[model samples]
Target: MALKDKQTEKNKHFIASLEFALQGIRTVFKEERNMRTHSLMGVLAIIAGFIFRLTTVEWLWLLFVIFFVLIIEIINTAFENVVDMCTDFHFHPIGKKIKDMAAGAVLITACFSLIVGSIIFLPKIWQLFVTYFL
Candidate 1:
């Protein structure tokens, strides 16, 4: 293909690739309860951030951590899926270990992100409630 033709082909398929990616997201969200919970938490965090009017840097950090947890959760799900596929739903110690590690990763990331969210938002939230009472 000519250079310009190749470029055109790539451009044409970009939207298709995005559609496929979105489809994956939809399927995961539909099938995974944890994903649904995380998405709800993410939305609530966004709402809280807006309510508090977090600074640009604070928003960046908050968003980074939020997205970090979510990305890890998605990876963990995919890892578990691959493990299950390999083990064919049978009882394998190694498969169990692999799945446990993936779950642990999600747990660790969620905890870390919770700390980050608290650090960034807790002070502001405390002030809001404290002032209302005072």
Candidate 2:
């Protein structure tokens, strides 16, 4: 669960920070189609985990995979937005390269997430198939 700040005057800055961070999440979900796809994937992963009756340790690792991928995806969105904001008319090679690298980062995270999901889910799914269909 996400940590919550105490509702006190002393915690105003912390509360505001949390709000800003949440706004980033909202922005990404609204503006990035890839973010929506990631959300769908996360939901499906959780549902599959429930179906497979994942161990606590496996669940924890899956949760880490979910959060890490989402975080990198958000960072990728932020990087692209910042690049667009900085460049106006014509494209700069450096900006293009930077944007490409940011996209590559997201792609790398996605590939890693897929590998982890396969490692965690594939054997369970295979067993289910063998037990019922094979």
Candidate 3:
């Protein structure tokens, strides 16, 4: 009986956790600018994958990179907002460092995604050119 009660409690907690997660998703879509940008990037990435005729594995890798950048951007934005909320004054070295570090993370992720995209697409483009005109 105790084991069954524990299992029931666990199920209830899981359902409540899922509800909270859904609310978070709704709030992210409703209020986050970075989320909007990420959504746009996701759409572009899907369109590009189709246009480039990527193999299934290559498309998976490309989407991974795209999602990785967006995830990093969202985390970075969250960090910045939290820092800003905690500090309202200018010229605070710690605050500046925190924001700078977060921004640097986003920049690094963006550069990495760019490199992955180039590596995946450049060869295919060259081959298409050769097949068409050479």
TM for every model, in the order presented, reads: 0.88, 0.89, 0.74
lDDT of 2 by residue, 100-120 (tens): 999999888889989999999
> RMSD, model 2, all Cα superposed?
6.0
Model 1: lDDT equals 0.89
C-alpha local distance difference test of each model = 0.89, 0.89, 0.81
Candidate 2, pairs of clashing residues: none
> lDDT tens string, model 1, 18-92?
999899888889888998898889889999999999999989988998888888888988988898899888979
Between candidates 1 and 3, the one scoring higher on lDDT is 1
How does candidate 3 score on lDDT? Answer: 0.81
lDDT of 2 at 112: 90
Candidate 3 worst ten-residue window by lDDT: 1-10
Error of 3 at 79 (Å): 0.9
**In terms of TM-score, which candidate is strongest?**
2
